[model samples]
Target: MALLGGIKEVPANQNSVEADELARFAVNEHNKKENALLEFSKVVKVKEQVVSGTMYHITLEASDGGQKKVYEAKIWVKFAWVLMS
Candidate 1:
């Protein structure tokens, strides 16, 4: 499924399970690396690009120090590895 394609927006709804999970992972990873406490809120948007596996660009809202803020995260998931930014 790695035919390589341009980035495209995926169907993003409030109940998107994969997007939500990725958002959570992004927040957790960020908290661990930055030592900043951030609470995962919800996924606001989702996009994907076919890379070696798949690159997911997600926009999410999270509580930062009790303030709700929107943030962007890029996660490259290739089954064996997950890179977050």
Candidate 2:
């Protein structure tokens, strides 16, 4: 069993849709912040640590004009609670 705050490995595939989406999100976010022109290729690895929400550690590959380089991104996801009357 993995602890909530401890990082745990997540099974990911380079050709998987979920992996690709996450990779794309990482690249897009980077481009937005750093004004980079990286193209998402695939995801190499993934890991997660749970806190109040979840923090994802994603290793991905992307192309910057020519060669594909590996980049790591940490994405934190926090879910909001909805109040139903």
lDDT (10s digit) by residue, model 1, range 1-85:
4345788888766339988888899999999999999999888899888888879999999998899999999999885676999
Q: Give candidate 1's TM-score.
A: 0.83
> Residue 39 of model 2: what lDDT?
92
RMSD to true structure for each model, in Å: 6.7, 2.5
For residue 23, model 1's alpha carbon misses the true position, in angstroms, by: 0.7
* TM-score for candidate 2, residues paired by index: 0.83
TM-score of each: 0.83, 0.83
Stretches of model 1 off by over 4 angstroms after superposition: 1-3, 79-85
Q: Tens-digit lDDT track for model 2 on 35-77?
A: 9999988788888888778787889888998899999998887
Candidate maximizing lDDT? 1
Clashing pairs in 1: none
| Model 1 C-alpha lDDT versus the unseen true structure | 0.88
The reply for model 2, stretches above 4 Å from the true place, is 13-16, 82-85
